[model samples]
Target: MNNVKNLNKWANAHTYLSLDLVRIALGVFLFMKGISFITNIQYLQDLISPIDKIGGGMFLIHYIAPAHMVGGIMIAFGLLTRWAIIAQLPILIGAIIVNFMGEMHSQNLLLAILILGICVFFLFYGSGKHSADYYFKMQQ
Candidate 1:
Protein backbone atom coordinates (compact mmCIF):
# COMPACT_ATOMS: atom_id res chain seq x y z
CA MET A 1 0.00 0.00 0.00
CA ASN A 2 2.81 2.40 0.86
CA ASN A 3 4.62 1.52 -2.36
CA VAL A 4 1.43 2.10 -4.34
CA LYS A 5 0.98 5.51 -2.72
CA ASN A 6 4.59 6.46 -3.44
CA LEU A 7 4.22 5.44 -7.08
CA ASN A 8 1.09 7.54 -7.45
CA LYS A 9 2.80 10.53 -5.93
CA TRP A 10 5.73 10.13 -8.27
CA ALA A 11 3.45 9.91 -11.26
CA ASN A 12 1.55 12.99 -10.21
CA ALA A 13 4.74 14.97 -9.72
CA HIS A 14 6.00 13.98 -13.13
CA THR A 15 2.75 14.96 -14.78
CA TYR A 16 2.72 18.27 -12.97
CA LEU A 17 6.27 19.17 -13.95
CA SER A 18 6.02 18.10 -17.58
CA LEU A 19 5.32 21.64 -18.72
CA ASP A 20 8.46 22.85 -16.99
CA LEU A 21 10.46 20.21 -18.82
CA VAL A 22 8.97 21.35 -22.11
CA ARG A 23 9.85 24.93 -21.34
CA ILE A 24 13.41 23.97 -20.48
CA ALA A 25 13.85 21.99 -23.67
CA LEU A 26 12.45 24.76 -25.85
CA GLY A 27 14.60 27.32 -24.07
CA VAL A 28 17.77 25.39 -24.68
CA PHE A 29 16.93 24.91 -28.33
CA LEU A 30 16.12 28.55 -28.91
CA PHE A 31 19.25 29.64 -27.12
CA MET A 32 21.43 27.36 -29.19
CA LYS A 33 19.77 28.42 -32.43
CA GLY A 34 20.24 32.07 -31.50
CA ILE A 35 23.85 31.46 -30.63
CA SER A 36 24.35 29.77 -33.96
CA PHE A 37 22.99 32.81 -35.75
CA ILE A 38 25.21 35.11 -33.74
CA THR A 39 28.27 32.96 -34.38
CA ASN A 40 27.55 32.53 -38.09
CA ILE A 41 25.97 35.86 -38.86
CA GLN A 42 27.31 36.33 -42.35
CA TYR A 43 26.44 32.78 -43.39
CA LEU A 44 22.92 32.98 -41.97
CA GLN A 45 22.41 36.43 -43.42
CA ASP A 46 23.39 35.23 -46.85
CA LEU A 47 21.08 32.27 -46.50
CA ILE A 48 18.23 34.37 -45.18
CA SER A 49 18.52 37.46 -47.40
CA PRO A 50 16.31 36.14 -50.15
CA ILE A 51 13.56 35.46 -47.67
CA ASP A 52 14.15 38.83 -46.05
CA LYS A 53 13.91 40.60 -49.41
CA ILE A 54 10.68 38.82 -50.13
CA GLY A 55 9.25 40.40 -47.01
CA GLY A 56 10.34 43.94 -48.03
CA GLY A 57 13.77 43.92 -46.40
CA MET A 58 12.82 44.33 -42.79
CA PHE A 59 15.24 43.41 -39.97
CA LEU A 60 13.81 40.00 -39.33
CA ILE A 61 17.14 38.27 -39.71
CA HIS A 62 18.96 40.82 -37.62
CA TYR A 63 16.24 41.12 -35.00
CA ILE A 64 15.44 37.50 -34.21
CA ALA A 65 18.88 36.62 -32.91
CA PRO A 66 18.64 38.78 -29.79
CA ALA A 67 14.97 37.99 -29.31
CA HIS A 68 15.70 34.29 -29.36
CA MET A 69 18.47 34.65 -26.83
CA VAL A 70 16.41 36.79 -24.44
CA GLY A 71 13.25 34.78 -24.81
CA GLY A 72 15.15 31.55 -24.37
CA ILE A 73 16.73 32.75 -21.16
CA MET A 74 13.40 33.98 -19.77
CA ILE A 75 11.64 30.73 -20.63
CA ALA A 76 14.48 28.61 -19.30
CA PHE A 77 14.43 30.40 -15.98
CA GLY A 78 10.65 30.47 -15.82
CA LEU A 79 10.65 34.24 -15.61
CA LEU A 80 7.88 36.08 -17.43
CA THR A 81 7.49 32.91 -19.39
CA ARG A 82 4.24 33.63 -21.21
CA TRP A 83 5.55 36.98 -22.33
CA ALA A 84 8.76 35.39 -23.50
CA ILE A 85 6.90 32.75 -25.44
CA ILE A 86 4.77 35.45 -27.03
CA ALA A 87 7.90 37.31 -28.03
CA GLN A 88 9.33 34.12 -29.54
CA LEU A 89 6.29 33.25 -31.69
CA PRO A 90 7.31 35.41 -34.62
CA ILE A 91 10.73 33.82 -34.83
CA LEU A 92 9.28 30.36 -34.47
CA ILE A 93 6.65 30.96 -37.14
CA GLY A 94 9.22 32.52 -39.45
CA ALA A 95 11.50 29.56 -38.93
CA ILE A 96 8.74 27.13 -39.86
CA ILE A 97 7.95 29.08 -42.99
CA VAL A 98 11.57 29.44 -43.99
CA ASN A 99 12.21 25.75 -43.49
CA PHE A 100 9.10 24.93 -45.49
CA MET A 101 10.20 27.14 -48.34
CA GLY A 102 13.93 26.48 -48.31
CA GLU A 103 15.81 23.23 -48.79
CA MET A 104 13.04 21.48 -46.87
CA HIS A 105 15.37 19.62 -44.60
CA SER A 106 13.31 17.01 -42.85
CA GLN A 107 15.16 17.33 -39.57
CA ASN A 108 14.89 21.12 -39.55
CA LEU A 109 11.19 20.98 -40.33
CA LEU A 110 10.59 18.49 -37.55
CA LEU A 111 12.54 20.57 -35.03
CA ALA A 112 10.69 23.74 -35.97
CA ILE A 113 7.37 21.97 -35.58
CA LEU A 114 8.35 20.61 -32.20
CA ILE A 115 9.53 24.00 -30.97
CA LEU A 116 6.41 25.71 -32.25
CA GLY A 117 4.25 23.15 -30.49
CA ILE A 118 6.14 23.61 -27.25
CA CYS A 119 5.78 27.39 -27.49
CA VAL A 120 2.05 27.00 -28.03
CA PHE A 121 1.83 24.70 -25.05
CA PHE A 122 3.51 27.23 -22.79
CA LEU A 123 1.40 30.02 -24.22
CA PHE A 124 -1.68 28.25 -22.88
CA TYR A 125 -0.41 26.36 -19.82
CA GLY A 126 1.88 29.02 -18.31
CA SER A 127 5.23 28.59 -16.57
CA GLY A 128 4.03 26.08 -13.95
CA LYS A 129 5.05 25.91 -10.28
CA HIS A 130 8.78 25.45 -10.67
CA SER A 131 9.52 28.91 -12.01
CA ALA A 132 10.81 32.33 -11.10
CA ASP A 133 7.34 33.66 -11.72
CA TYR A 134 6.06 31.40 -8.99
CA TYR A 135 8.84 32.49 -6.71
CA PHE A 136 8.06 36.14 -7.27
CA LYS A 137 4.38 35.47 -6.71
CA MET A 138 5.19 33.76 -3.46
CA GLN A 139 7.23 36.72 -2.30
CA GLN A 140 4.22 38.92 -2.70
Candidate 2:
Protein backbone atom coordinates (compact mmCIF):
# COMPACT_ATOMS: atom_id res chain seq x y z
CA MET A 1 0.00 0.00 0.00
CA ASN A 2 2.84 2.36 0.78
CA ASN A 3 4.50 1.42 -2.49
CA VAL A 4 1.37 2.19 -4.42
CA LYS A 5 1.05 5.52 -2.65
CA ASN A 6 4.64 6.40 -3.43
CA LEU A 7 4.23 5.40 -7.06
CA ASN A 8 1.10 7.50 -7.35
CA LYS A 9 2.91 10.44 -5.80
CA TRP A 10 5.82 10.08 -8.22
CA ALA A 11 3.43 9.76 -11.18
CA ASN A 12 1.49 12.82 -10.10
CA ALA A 13 4.70 14.82 -9.85
CA HIS A 14 5.68 13.77 -13.39
CA THR A 15 2.31 14.42 -15.02
CA TYR A 16 2.34 16.26 -18.33
CA LEU A 17 -0.14 17.41 -20.95
CA SER A 18 1.40 15.18 -23.63
CA LEU A 19 0.90 12.11 -21.50
CA ASP A 20 -2.73 13.04 -20.98
CA LEU A 21 -3.19 13.40 -24.73
CA VAL A 22 -1.61 10.01 -25.29
CA ARG A 23 -3.97 8.48 -22.75
CA ILE A 24 -6.91 10.00 -24.56
CA ALA A 25 -5.64 8.68 -27.87
CA LEU A 26 -5.14 5.24 -26.39
CA GLY A 27 -8.71 5.24 -25.08
CA VAL A 28 -10.11 6.26 -28.44
CA PHE A 29 -8.08 3.60 -30.19
CA LEU A 30 -9.29 0.87 -27.86
CA PHE A 31 -12.88 2.04 -28.20
CA MET A 32 -12.61 1.97 -31.98
CA LYS A 33 -11.12 -1.51 -31.84
CA GLY A 34 -14.06 -2.63 -29.74
CA ILE A 35 -16.46 -1.19 -32.25
CA SER A 36 -14.56 -2.92 -35.00
CA PHE A 37 -14.81 -6.25 -33.21
CA ILE A 38 -18.55 -5.80 -32.72
CA THR A 39 -19.13 -4.87 -36.33
CA ASN A 40 -17.11 -7.77 -37.68
CA ILE A 41 -17.16 -10.46 -35.07
CA GLN A 42 -16.10 -13.01 -37.61
CA TYR A 43 -12.79 -11.20 -37.89
CA LEU A 44 -12.32 -11.38 -34.15
CA GLN A 45 -13.24 -15.06 -34.16
CA ASP A 46 -10.74 -15.73 -36.88
CA LEU A 47 -8.08 -13.92 -34.92
CA ILE A 48 -8.83 -16.02 -31.88
CA SER A 49 -9.18 -19.31 -33.76
CA PRO A 50 -6.19 -20.85 -32.01
CA ILE A 51 -7.70 -20.12 -28.62
CA ASP A 52 -11.14 -21.17 -29.83
CA LYS A 53 -9.78 -24.61 -30.68
CA ILE A 54 -8.70 -25.03 -27.07
CA GLY A 55 -12.21 -24.10 -25.81
CA GLY A 56 -13.59 -21.10 -23.79
CA GLY A 57 -12.93 -18.80 -26.72
CA MET A 58 -16.61 -18.07 -26.83
CA PHE A 59 -16.43 -16.50 -23.38
CA LEU A 60 -13.44 -14.38 -24.40
CA ILE A 61 -15.27 -13.24 -27.52
CA HIS A 62 -18.11 -11.96 -25.40
CA TYR A 63 -15.82 -10.44 -22.82
CA ILE A 64 -13.42 -8.53 -25.04
CA ALA A 65 -15.71 -6.20 -26.97
CA PRO A 66 -17.72 -4.96 -24.02
CA ALA A 67 -14.72 -4.59 -21.76
CA HIS A 68 -12.89 -2.57 -24.35
CA MET A 69 -15.91 -0.41 -25.03
CA VAL A 70 -16.68 0.40 -21.40
CA GLY A 71 -13.12 0.33 -20.14
CA GLY A 72 -12.01 2.64 -22.91
CA ILE A 73 -14.55 5.22 -21.78
CA MET A 74 -13.40 5.00 -18.18
CA ILE A 75 -9.76 5.33 -19.23
CA ALA A 76 -10.49 8.30 -21.46
CA PHE A 77 -12.26 10.16 -18.70
CA GLY A 78 -9.64 9.06 -16.14
CA LEU A 79 -12.56 7.86 -14.04
CA LEU A 80 -11.28 4.80 -12.23
CA THR A 81 -8.54 4.62 -14.84
CA ARG A 82 -6.46 2.05 -13.02
CA TRP A 83 -9.41 -0.26 -12.61
CA ALA A 84 -10.33 0.14 -16.25
CA ILE A 85 -6.76 -0.68 -17.31
CA ILE A 86 -6.72 -3.67 -15.00
CA ALA A 87 -9.79 -5.04 -16.76
CA GLN A 88 -8.08 -4.53 -20.11
CA LEU A 89 -4.78 -6.19 -19.13
CA PRO A 90 -5.99 -9.74 -19.65
CA ILE A 91 -7.52 -8.96 -23.01
CA LEU A 92 -4.31 -7.29 -24.18
CA ILE A 93 -2.19 -10.17 -22.97
CA GLY A 94 -4.47 -12.63 -24.73
CA ALA A 95 -4.28 -10.58 -27.89
CA ILE A 96 -0.48 -10.93 -27.93
CA ILE A 97 -0.66 -14.64 -27.19
CA VAL A 98 -3.22 -15.23 -29.90
CA ASN A 99 -1.07 -13.50 -32.49
CA PHE A 100 1.77 -15.90 -31.77
CA MET A 101 -0.37 -19.05 -31.35
CA GLY A 102 -2.19 -18.54 -34.60
CA GLU A 103 -1.19 -17.03 -37.91
CA MET A 104 1.06 -14.10 -37.08
CA HIS A 105 0.04 -10.88 -38.70
CA SER A 106 2.94 -8.50 -38.17
CA GLN A 107 0.65 -5.51 -38.14
CA ASN A 108 -1.69 -6.99 -35.55
CA LEU A 109 1.16 -8.23 -33.38
CA LEU A 110 2.88 -4.86 -33.46
CA LEU A 111 -0.30 -3.02 -32.60
CA ALA A 112 -1.08 -5.35 -29.70
CA ILE A 113 2.44 -5.06 -28.31
CA LEU A 114 2.42 -1.29 -28.63
CA ILE A 115 -0.93 -1.00 -26.94
CA LEU A 116 0.11 -3.40 -24.20
CA GLY A 117 3.23 -1.37 -23.56
CA ILE A 118 1.21 1.82 -23.33
CA CYS A 119 -1.30 0.16 -21.00
CA VAL A 120 1.48 -1.02 -18.71
CA PHE A 121 2.98 2.46 -18.70
CA PHE A 122 -0.36 3.96 -17.72
CA LEU A 123 -0.87 1.30 -15.08
CA PHE A 124 2.10 2.75 -13.22
CA TYR A 125 1.74 6.34 -14.35
CA GLY A 126 -1.90 6.73 -13.34
CA SER A 127 -3.97 9.51 -14.87
CA GLY A 128 -2.19 12.88 -15.16
CA LYS A 129 -3.00 16.17 -13.48
CA HIS A 130 -5.40 17.13 -16.27
CA SER A 131 -7.56 14.06 -15.77
CA ALA A 132 -10.87 13.59 -14.00
CA ASP A 133 -9.03 11.66 -11.30
CA TYR A 134 -6.91 14.66 -10.39
CA TYR A 135 -9.82 17.05 -10.76
CA PHE A 136 -11.93 15.03 -8.38
CA LYS A 137 -9.03 14.65 -5.97
CA MET A 138 -8.59 18.39 -5.96
CA GLN A 139 -12.30 18.83 -5.31
CA GLN A 140 -12.09 16.52 -2.34
Strongest candidate by lDDT:
2
Candidate 1 local distance difference test against the native: 0.77
**What is the Cα-based lDDT of residue 129 in candidate 2?**
79
Residue pairs whose backbone atoms clash in candidate 2: none
lDDT of 1 by residue, 47-95 (tens): 5664875774447766888889988999999898878999988777877
Model 2 misses residue 62 by how many Å?
1.0
Q: TM-score per candidate, in order?
A: 0.81, 0.95
RMSD of 2: 1.0
- TM-score for predicted model 1 compared with the true structure: 0.81
lDDT of 2: 0.90
Please report, in order, the local distance difference test score of every candidate based on alpha carbons: 0.77, 0.90
